[model samples]
Target: MKTFKSILAAILIVGTAGFLMSCESELESKGTASIGVTDAAVDAENISGVYLKVNEVQATAQGKTKTVVAFDSPKTFNVMDYQSGATYDLGEGQIDAGSYSELRFILDEGSYVKFKDGTTADLDVPSGTTSGYKVKGDYEINSDSRTNLVVDIDLRKAFVKTGSGEYKLRSTARIVNKDRSAVINGTVSGNTADKVVVYAYEKGTYKESETAEPADGESRFENSINSAVVANGQFTMAYMEEGEYDLIAVAYDENPEEDTYAFRSASEVDMMVAGSLLSVLKVEANANINVLINLDF
Candidate 1:
């Protein structure tokens, strides 16, 4: 009886050791994914900052979700500060080496927007804490290598004011492999409008309805792949995937009293003599393309 009990104990100890070894091996097989966030220019007047508190970032691979970045405490970021090709690193974590189909950002409360006049209003994120915001794309993580990713949040289309005189987040964001994306930089001259915004759409994706006034709680150019506000006669749309895109320049009337930029009209491009030969601009990975848009105001 004593000999049998001793053998049973030894077997239990061996089994436990093997289980721990398996877990360690699984952890060692993971790769590191470094994530960051960026934003395009917001198309509103007197807006000083857009703040967001991120609790964590998760990735889904083969229908299994795992955290790739977890903060000790919720990290608050002024997303507006990372515009025009700038990014804010959200830190890194280990993820299983595989192809992820989607990435989500879990946010916390206390997100708000500050205006230039020392006033702030709560920016509500619907289902931000529960469902989170998702960015769908194909991302590959190799074992023992670090992959860099940047989440581009186009604030122009994302920030909307509700009927109750409140603001809410209806964001459109995309995750791109930092090393595999490109940037579009250009100058907009000969403009007489109060403001100029450049919108980039996938080839042949722009529609006349996009220029129409959006319904309540919506904004124009909602379907643009990305957008940039002309600043000091220059504009930049970064982290764009390699493909052909159509550029649309639009004019706006800035009303500082109401803190709004009302849509005016879509500007005509100077087709004959501009930086880009064609309206359809071709962008390549890891390259910068300059497109000049001389608006016929």
Candidate 2:
């Protein structure tokens, strides 16, 4: 349980020889630390708002975890509104100058998601409402530098809907070093179909893989980045880490009777970024997107 100052003093004493050097370069000194949240572009077109009530924010270093900011009570954010670089500031505080290995957030009840059909349901965060959701990352906080972190709650992989209509929240948060992130913006056209979804999967992903859910404590990492839903034919992929990616847009049939879900995908598009440029791409859907599903029956 070393204070930020003591940790910095130790690093200075060692002249930041090894890991400390990398961390020091990546972290800030005498700067403020803030936590924000963003969405990973879900195809939940009917889901308008996914509000989460966060109770406490904590950071850990040197084997000791401390609450950086505890809500006087609790606060909620409609996660859907945070997309493509958009974020809801959880809060800010003086970050300790140490090698932080993890970050956690305690959530409370009163979390729910609303739908476009005027229906709303509770978002069940199994054990998360009281237990908290945590993820790992390296953070070095110096005295005068700003350290900002954003959490990517992959709504596509995190929010699961069961046959019995149970809404579950899986622990699938991706922490990002905000200063080193990029954004992707795009648009969809020739899509007259309802419930058209656009996703940014890692290149070489199988289209059917979208149905696979992550294990309780696993990352669904194989090209599973979801895309922000299109608004007025425009879409955005925010807070992306540097890498190559493939984009796919699908329009699904909502018929409940069929066990198999039928959908159409747009022609694949490729994306890549090495630095901080907000990349953009255009994806065209299959020409028959306007076809009626019931017509087949």
> Which candidate's lDDT is highest?
1
Candidate 1 residues 11-97, lDDT tens each?
Answer: 999999999999998887889999988898687677899899999999998888899888879999898999889999899999899
Q: Give the Å shift of residue 243 in candidate 2.
A: 2.0
- Give the Å shift of residue 97 in candidate 2: 2.4
Question: What value does the lDDT take at residue 215 in candidate 2?
Answer: 53
Give RMSD (Å) of candidate 1 vs. truth: 4.6
TM-score of 1: 0.85
Model 2 scores worst on lDDT over the 10 consecutive residues at: 288-297
The lDDT of model 1 is 0.84
TM-score of 2: 0.67
lDDT of each: 0.84, 0.65
Per-residue error (Å), model 2, residue 83: 2.4
Sliding window of 10 residues with minimal summed lDDT for model 1: 267-276
Clashes of each: 0, 14
